[model samples]
Target: MRIGILGAGRMADALGTQWARAGHELMVSGRAPEKAAALAERIGPAARVGTFREAATFGDAVLLAIRDDGVQDVLAAAGAADGTLQGRVLVDCTNPVVPEKLTLKTAGGPSMAERVAAATRAHVVKAFNLCHEDVWRMTPPVFDGVKLAVPLCGDDPDALALVRTLVTGLGCEPIDGGALERAALLEATAAFMIGLWFSGANAQAVIPPLKYAFGAH
Candidate 1:
């Protein structure tokens, strides 16, 4: 898949590294073309850097990776909210974190994904905004892999499926988190996750999942 990831920040770079490792071609773009280029080089030959407009047009499925406050601007820049996103599966990996507290600020609660979907009327899927990028990128004590679970929410069937497949490609299990509004729970969970960062070893995590699958041991 030729993925257009909009942003050159940590999350964008993380996605680029994993996608490139998964043998997918990527167009990495952001406000800084030079930073995007450096990110592309670091990710390897399968990924290339370009301008935001180019990335938006070049991607088969676009990953909107940016700060919550920045989402509106980035989407506007990409002309996404103007229906430029139709027929494309948009993976919106944004947690509505307020700049001040670094916690979610969207209240009266429809979730960030829902708001985004309502704005664009695009097939938007909520994914990958939880969890810390650096920890996930750590040098693991390896096995085949420690498959991390990532929950996704969206109403669009095709869009969800596409995102699920991409999640698999990124070495994570994509749990169907039901409709897009469910993202409210997921986003609110962002705060508990932030608290965890201070509690001990778990705080630096993303939408920390509470569910567990146990087997007879």
Candidate 2:
């Protein structure tokens, strides 16, 4: 699979490295050319660095690994070349939480994924916003006897399938999180989890077992 990543940060490094190791072709792009090149080199020989437009145009799927605030700018750059991102599956791995209070930055209007979808012609999928980058570094990302579950929300079936494949490639289970309109729930989940983590609270304990939380099945 050909994957284009739109950032040079930790999220980009972590996910890009894993995908590259899985034998996928990778192209990394960032605001800084040198930083993008550096990230591609760090991901090994299967990856290359290119301009945002080129990266967006080169992939079967594009992963937006940039900060929440910069997503629009990056997508704008990527789409500048004759609407390069049109009809592409754009996987958004961003959380719109403000660090200071762990509250959602876009608390009212639209979810980050919704905004992304509206900004471009790409099919936007919200995913990988639930955990830290280090968590993605764990081989298989399993705990106890269960594989970690990755929930994604998107409107496109094909785009969802593509993201599901990527999630499985990380050795995690892919959970259908409903339509793209529901992406705000995932963003809120991130905020809640992050707040718990920062407050030294065991967020996992807050959720009852499936039999209890969702009734006997």
> CA shift at 200, candidate 1, in angstroms?
2.1
Cα error of candidate 2 at position 136, Å:
0.5
What value does the lDDT take at residue 199 in candidate 1?
60
lDDT of 1 by residue, 124-156 (tens): 888887777764463331235657778998888
Model 1 weakest 10-residue run by lDDT: 208-217
Give lDDT per model, in order: 0.77, 0.91
In model 2, the runs with Cα more than 4 Å from the true position are 214-217
TM-score of each: 0.84, 0.96
Clashing pairs in 2: none
